[model samples]
Target chain A: MSTIRIAQLSCGTEYSGVQFEIESAARAVGAKIVYPDVSYSQVKEALDRFGFKPKSTQLQLMIARAMSLADRKFEADAVFITTCFRCAEAALVRNELRRFIQENTRLPVVTYSFTERLKAAQLLTRMEALVTIVTRKELLARERQSGITAGIDSGSSTTKAVIMENNKIIGKDWTPSGAVVVETAEQVLANAMKEAGVEMKDIEAMGTTGYGRFTVGKHFNCKLIQEELTVNSKGAVWLANRQRGEATIIDIGGMDNKAITVRDGIPDNFTMGGICAGASGRFLQMTANRLKIDIQDLGAMAVKGNWANAKMNSYCSVFGIQDLVTSLGEGKKFEDVAAAACHSVAEQVYEQQLQEIDVRHPIIEVGGTSLISGLVKAVGEVLGEEPIVPPHSQYIGAVGGALLSSGFL
Target chain B: MKVFIDPPNSMVLFDLVERFGHEPLSSMAVIQEKIDNIEVDMPPMNVTLDDVVRGLKYAGVEVPSGIRGRMSLWGPMIEAADAAIIIDNAPFSFGCVGCDRSNELTKYLIHRRGIPALTVKYPTDEAEAKIMVGQIKDFLGGLKQ
Candidate 1:
């Protein structure tokens, strides 16, 4: 009954599934959609004014344009917008995009963080039922798409190998990060191909993404490679929609932690991890070991936990143990202590993140620690809500990796 | 060559100790809390080098001492090391040496000597790390371009 105006802006290199989901969600929501317009309009205009495209100039310039466009759109109940994924991952571009939006639009700015989808629920109509769309293999295998079209995602701590049969996920594999990216990529390619029950010969026109993708590509071979963000967004949208309704994705893995918002079931805005491991998987794992509990149980237990009054620990893993032990001796309950740990972790992440990421919707937690049910609850509590723990939470990254590798990204 | 391993409880320290010629002592920074999280060989991780003296004496950061001597610096206690072999599985670059220029220089020399420095932080991609390793290898390999 309402006509919501939505704009979906992504760099030319953004993943396909992410685009599709956004478009689809808008269609379902009856929102008038705009594409390729955000704070980056100036850069886009600047590009137009200079009579030079990205290839003619620096990659940074082009990245800036895309971010600007995204930021402008985010100003409107723009749902999800990305910020501070990393300084190295085209930050200036994103800043210009953000600056333009803050200067130009009257819309409330909302960062697409793990909190977005979990919080977007505040806007859901009481009468509208949650609509879930799970593609499984259909989107990944669309016959209309072909020609080594692909996406790649390489994390600092892990490598994901995905194979798509016409953009439909055919296989996926997750491998530990290697000192040499190319060597690991080769291993990923072999593993993904076998998992899809297919062979390397069957693949044509390969695309890749990730920090290691470049090195991996140099060693192995590929027809194309996409940005890691794009691949992750697309895969996340596809995977999230399969279960319940489309929402934002919170991927807290071993190394790279990300929060992707899917408005109308698409990637709107997202955020990623920085140098601090405070809210990261390794930190959680370390804390788990410190408590002598397994990482697997950390989440579920937190969800069931009672309150405790532990001191806020330092971000360092070494410091956290001492703080917790000291708190325990001081009579802090395990539940409160656990909650405090989770709070500090989330606080560490949100500290540098953009303000205004809605904290009331159904947040779909993904990545390695995303499997920790308690962490989700604890993080949600700190953010003022409870997040949705999905099935196949740990495999989401691998799933995304496969889809991108298969050309979906 | 020195290796700077964190979370002193790591097996990596022991592995480094066994593989390398060093006894891989824990960073006086905090062992126990000091144990390395890595999967290498190293010496026993004990003792926490803190700015306890500075915090109590001057309310600032200072250099942590090793079994060998008082590796003095300024500010809160700086972790002690000779050369460093960082093996962090996470991707973090926002580390600072505080105001203890002396100790900071010492740690820097250990890392700058360029033997093997590994560090881990989060939210970074694997490819990026690989590129760095590739560069380091290239430097070490000195494969004539």
Candidate 2:
């Protein structure tokens, strides 16, 4: 039987973890995911053709691309939209695009709102359910076939590899990415291959996605390379599949922060901040080092301490470390100081990146930083609501890459 | 004596006014006050709907309403000045599209006010800059006399 095809649209970022989950879910349900060849220039062309001047804001550009995507030709049974939450612009754009799709096409459209607190089980259930629903009508139309595929996600901090056979994840491996990304990608892929008991000849297809994906793909000679935002959004939605309403995906990585709004099951819009490490995991790591504490322990210490009154006002990581030292010398308890540090990062994100965005509830936290219990707690306190953190959040990107190889060759 | 300066944020004019021992009236102070008291996570201070209404009310001109709102903000400052110095073709002075009208109205109001006003173009070369400074010095000195 011919495999069902799903077209994925998103602003590609490497950290969101949505792409991995969507691919996995699609593969499990006997479907193939395809990405469109839409670019900003094409979007501009479409806007010009429609007599619309280019807008200065990034959200407007993304919306323009989405509007143009509707007119472009591609073969797919369904359309999925993924975006960040709390984006006022995305909310406005999504409403317009939803109407455009309704008026222009008969294909089923589903939008997933990705946030930092999305659960893997919820995402998987929804994806599996989507696949079932999409494929149900054509069940007797095609013959079923399955094979093995591999995905490698070479992120800033780590390289992850996952091998899948007939939609189920059979084997996966991850290792710290050191000085040479090429070597790390090779090592991780080798490790995954060994565990899966499969050779290069045995794998049907291979795909690479992440920050270092382009470099790694060139070194390894892999043909299929996907954008990080596309895969991460896909992965996040697949994981948070069960979520029924609007949510924002906040991925705080080592050096960057991503906020993706998922409305329903599709990603709507996204914003990113990474010019400095002040609003990222690097900030927390640096603060922990200055406190002479392990990074992992900072969160627990923060929870026990009361430093709501103490201020760490520096937005630069180096300046923040100085602020931490000054606070400690001023007789502030270590626990309180640490908690305050976490609070400061949260505040910076709120003030800088998310100020214009009216963030929706049930914030889903992802990326490696989401593991920091104290930072999560601080973000909750700042937002005046708790977030959902799914298990194995770091591997969502890698899994999304693997799922991309699903469908007919 | 109060002297009004165009491109209200010009530090050069502000410093010259203080150096010449005069009170300089500009919109920078008002803008700064708004920025200082802004609520966290909100859009940065800019010309807002309220400012437009207030400016229109102050200008009391109905035709060519496009620039009336902005002109109102500068009208009161020009009215209180003993004299005015307008630096033409100033860097970063490409105001919004409607600014031409605002500029026209501002100059008209200053003319009507009947204050001793000096309009100077920003110097391009080092020699022109020196000459421009001399012209400004002479104008202020004449006012002092």
Candidate 3:
């Protein structure tokens, strides 16, 4: 039995006290700890090289420093990213950092969120479990067996599924979540399995996440059930592995708008708008219908048109539609009205969720709404920076659910 | 009639009191006004050395210096109120000022004033919320009679 070396990555100022506790826990679990030695300048340079903007929050800078150091042959068995529970920025930065480390290096990363309410015994249990998983992965790497895992994200508007084989995404599919959630979950799973050319019996482990997770999990008899925030964070990092440093995830779903701050490849802080809020896909669809245009075309039209200063102030979907009609009646260009609506949705998210917190750069916009180019542009304009929309942003949640199962396996 | 509310700065209680046709008195409002009116910039709602000494003189009881200082802020508001509503277990957000000591001191001062007071825990569910609203309506309705 070789000594398990774990690289501990965290914000030094916030978790100096917890670092001692983490060291003690690792010692109890028969593992040695290694901290990052990279300076702020080194981290900033690394982030610039990776195409991320230079300016970042303190927590994000710290996460970048950890990633930069990790990239340089750290020689650790596993990586542990701990963040203060209330520090939303750290959580988001940690997620991005985790992805950067995993993509750049073969080291398995596990994130632990530390809060005042967290007990020493509970922390030790999680630490012990992470170590066990890391040690097992090391042994399994020698003779990797072909194992398939499936994950289903049964969201309010869409049911998505992804199939993974040998720790890689093999197939993914999604469909409208109309009426029956359980049926939608089953259909999406079947679609993904069909695409992967695999049978239901081939799946070794299965997981479920999102709004209808419990119902879908019960129906599918999933081995794991995780929350939307955790799965989505994991998925965003897994999908967007190239972008380095802290990435803020703005997931505008059909019924809700979720602003997730991803620090170091882990979701640190998140805020969601009220259900059926105007800052979501449903609102955008409604606005497109009112404009007598396709929802997909709305983005392109906004981008092509000249309405940089167009403002849509209403936070209510009904009021927003009324505003759009009023603008159209006032002889405003259809594209300008559409652009204003998209911009308003972004502003609503910033005002209701992202305004209070320290939001970082390289904002990654995800979800079905992110597929709209105009909405992405509007969000970028509102945030005062271009936002990154990963390929297949719509299915990232499902991809994350699959990765969670695959990582555990 | 003036009604003092516990968890003093709550907009929910303030709105409820107004709906019941009574003037709502909150120690938080008084503290805010004092802090805002100060010519020199100072920490909001903080008890100065002068405030502590003055508070001790008015408290007329032997208590911890900190408790006496906190009491001074709530004492006047409670003394001037005709009725009181105390909400326990209010769900405060992360980093929001929901100090337990301040809440206890405010409740104690309100009780000392000997006015009609209703103590209720913050509702955890819809059923509890309905009960809470009913309790408030009943309390205020009886005051009118």
Candidate 4:
């Protein structure tokens, strides 16, 4: 297929990550980026009618397709499209484009604002630590020996990104994933590339996954993508196999959870976890912030010997806090209580898994909870072993992504 | 389509408005409400049309069909300003004085117009107006083609 061409339509003004994602995800695959805007006057009119529902929708539909008629000129095999949700300035225009996308374009048209993609990426990582990520090395030598491949996995909470030069980390960077997922992700990759001193053209193939993937995908000329899950798997495996070898990946994020089994150097048996709030990294992150603690220190604190019984009880984080405070009032140590909280999560997770399949080996925690030592220990104690937390465990999905782009497995 | 810009409040005409008897925000509110409904009523003053035109020129706006002498005709003056912009708070008109009433009136002047009139709040707005002038020039470029 001709270079994978992706398109992003956003608040023609705001800084969204769609462009950045396309730049990083499509780098190895030789992809191209396209940002299209409707005629300015048409866009203005669309925005002016934003107050009127029918008029807004009609205007948005028109604006969405305003300049999209030119898509025929591009030699693309598949077209991924994205728009901005809170584009107050371009609200009318985007509605028109949204309508146009709904009407035409058969390339599995996944249409959502960048915000949705950010949510989905987060959801996918939460469901499972994507075990197989496409990776591309910078050079033939490095590509063969180092098996270095770059994967830019831009999700909602944070940008989990990595670039491998020789199976050795050339450079890695993570930033708060912006509202513009693709654009910010790509910018992070660009920054990583500069920090690593790797030229952009050196990137052999690019694979973008998650919600922001489509908008970013438009910018990449080629990539291997089907859905957010597939890329997450590819991403998880590429990283999990490195740390745990046989990877039974669990990536829990702010919104969801996922479980995968990779055996014989391939994803063999896999069952995605149920949609659970307790399973997400972001929820834990918010909790940490609520408790007034830096998230990075959670694991270290869990390692402390003095254990307070965790006050958190009801699965909801807000109610869980009162549960935690009550435990403290009853005289439980913070470490013990936090660890117990972790145990509860693990028990809840394990219970859910028992409904699906037998518990496998090498469960790697990925996401916000994975970093909390108390939680990791609590869950591990229930599961009979401490789950492995690797360097950049939170970035497993992105690592798997780089591996996927590499065409390594 | 006539538009008048009110200068920033720190000017002499503000005092004139106070001298003429009108509340600032009330005047602004009334003018805005009127403009929203697309209506206009000009208040008479001792200020001459020559004073307005000469005053406009000093403020860096060259009005089309410049007004002559100390003419105080509000109807034709508003008519002359119908499609044109009246610069608010011109350096010459308001000078450096804090007159609330007149300042508010000047701001309302642009809104009083049925056409689009904008206050140059930021340098960017001014730049945009200049850009419109340049764009018009470019549009005229096509006639040569």
TM-score per candidate, chains pooled? 0.46, 0.50, 0.49, 0.45
Error of 2 at A3 (Å): 26
Candidate 4 docking classification: incorrect
Candidate 1 local lDDT, A1-409, one digit each (tens): 3355444333422332244444454555455445443254465665543222323233335434444544452332443333223222222223334434434553322222122122223212100111111112233322233433323446676676666665456666766778877777677767777877876666665656666655655555764443444455556556555433446566776765666555444443445554367667777777677677776777665666553456865866668768878887887766666667776676565444422232226666666666676677766765566666655455454445445444433
Docking quality (DockQ) of candidate 3: 0.01
The Cα error of candidate 4 at residue A305, in Å, is 5.9
Question: In model 2, which regions exceed 4 Å deviation?
Answer: A1-147, A165-167, A194-202, A221-223, A243-245, A356-358, A407-409, B1-145
lDDT of 2 by residue, A1-409 (tens): 6787776654432256666766766676577777666576766665433322322244345445555556756566666655555443343344334445544665555555556544444344334434543553232111211378777888877788877787566778888787988889888888889998999898887767777887977876664565554455445555555246767777787767767665553444445653368778889888888888888899899888875756688878888888888888888999889888888887667545553234666687877777788888988986778877776666667665666545434
Predicted candidate 1 versus true structure: per-residue lDDT over B1-145, tens digit per residue: 3334433333544454435455454434343333565443344532223322222221111112231122222212223444343333422232222223223233333433444444433225678757645543443233221
Greater-DockQ candidate between 2 and 4: 2
User: Model 2 lDDT vs. the true structure?
Assistant: 0.64
lDDT of 4 by residue, A1-409 (tens): 3454544444321355455553455433444545555565654554333222223343344443433543443233233334454433233223334334433543212223345245333223322221122221121111121344566766657776677765555767878878777668778887777777787778776655655666765666435432445555444544455433455666665555655554433443344434356545554565556456777775566566333345454655566666766776787765665555555566556544322222457766665457777777766775777777766676655555565566643
In model 3, how large is the Cα lDDT of residue B89?
72
| Predictions' DockQ, in order | 0.01, 0.02, 0.01, 0.01
User: Candidate 3: where is the Cα deviation over 4 Å?
Assistant: A1-146, A242-245, A308-311, B1-145
Better of 3 and 4 by TM-score: 3
* Distance from true location, Cα of A251 in model 1, Å: 2.4
